[model samples]
Target: MQEAFSQTKNASAVKNNYDRVAWFYDPLSRIVFRNAQIQAQQALIPYIPEHANILIAGGGTGGILEAIADQYPAGLRITYVEISEKMIRKAEKRFTGKNTVTFVHSAIEDYAAKSHFDVVITAFLFDNFTQEKADRIFQKLDKLLQPDGKWLFTDFHIDKKSSRSWKTWLLKSMYLFFKFFSEVEASQLPDTTSLFKKAGYHAIFTAFWYRKFIHSSIYQKP
Candidate 1:
C-alpha cells in the first residue's frame, strides 16, 4: 500500500486523468471504436504460450486480462501494471479468471525488480508518453523481457501512405481531447515501429484495425 501510494503521489498528470475517467474509459472506447479495440487485442492472443510468464503494462480496465483468462484457465503468471488507481480497481473487479494475476497500481516506469517474462504486452500504452519518457519506459520494459520473449504491442500508427487521411485529423482531435481531460504527455503519435526496429527487435506479425490507424503487432529479439 505504501509503495503504490508513493508511486502514485509522484506520477504525472496522466494518472489523475485516468482516475477521473476510469468509469467511462471502457464504454467510450466501445462507442467510438466498437469491437475494433477488442478485435485488435484478440489478434495477439494466439501468440501467447498456454503457460507463460507475462507482463501487461497499462492494462486498462482489465480488457486484456479478461481475454487472456478466457483463453488460459491455468498455468499463467501475469503482472498487470497501471498508473490509475480507479482504473486498477475497475480491472480488479473485471478479472475473474483462474490465472495467477497480480495487479499493481504503479506506472510501468516506477515498477521495479520484475522477473523476465516470456511475453510482454503493451496495448494503447505508448500513446501516452513523450519521446524521452517513452524511451525510458520502452527500455525498462525491454529489459524485463526474456531474450526469446515475444513483445505484443498494439497502438495507433502513422503511415506515409495515409499521412493525409481522415485518421490523421482524428488522431489530432483525440490528442487535444486527452490533453485537456487527461493531460497526457505526448502531443502526437510516435513511430513505434521504428522505435522497436532500431532496438534490434524484429516484427514477427502485425494486423491492422480501424482502417489501419490502429495496429496489433508481435515482435521478437532474433
Candidate 2:
C-alpha cells in the first residue's frame, strides 16, 4: 500500500512528519489556513446525494462524514480511508457513535471494497501528491467508481491571477512552510479536470472558492 508512496519522492517523509505532528493537526490546520476547510465543506454540501454510497479518501479527522451525516439521510453509507495511524485513532474517537461510517486505516490503493461507490469525495488531499502520483490516483479512482457515479473533490489551488494577490502569496508561503515540516510537496496541483477526463470521467460540475485558494470539481462516468 505504502510502497508506491514510499518510492515517490517525499511521500514517506511527509507521512512521517504528519505522524509526528498529528496531535496538533486540527488546531494548527484551522489557525494556519484560517477556516479555509470549513468554507470548502460548506461549498461541498450541495454536491452530495441523499442516497449516495460514498468513498472518502484521505479523510484525516473524519469531519466531512460528520457534515454528511448531519445533512444527508441516515441511509447513506460512507467508507472513510486515511493512511496516518494517529489520524485514524483520532477519527475513531471522533466518530465513535456514527454507525453509518466505516473506517479504513489504509491508503485508497490498499482498501478493497465490495462494490463500486456512487460518489467519491476527497477534501484537501489532492494537493499533497506529485503529478505522477496524482495521475496514478485518478487512474485508481476510475477503476473504483460505478457507472455514472460522481467524483467530487475539494483542495488547494495556486491563485496567481486572482484579484487577491497578497492572499494568494500568503497561502502559497504557508503551504511551503508546512511542506518543510510535513515533508509534503505544496506544488504540482494538476487541474484534476484534465486528469479525470483522461481517465474517462466527464465533467459534471465545478466550483472554486476565492478564485483558487479552495476549489471543488465534480465528474461523472458515462
RMSD of 2: 5.0
Clash pairs of candidate 1? Answer: none
lDDT of 2 by residue, 32-142 (tens): 676777667656667777667788888887667666656664667777777776676677665323436777766665566667898888887777777777777777877
Model 1 stretches astray by more than 4 angstroms: 1-7, 10-17
lDDT of each: 0.81, 0.68
The lDDT, on a scale of 0 to 1, for candidate 2 is: 0.68
Best by TM-score: 1
lDDT measured at residue 91 in model 1 versus the true structure, 0 to 100 = 79
List CA RMSD, all candidates. Answer: 2.6, 5.0
Give the TM-scores of the predictions, in the order they appear. Answer: 0.92, 0.80
Error of 2 at 32 (Å): 3.3
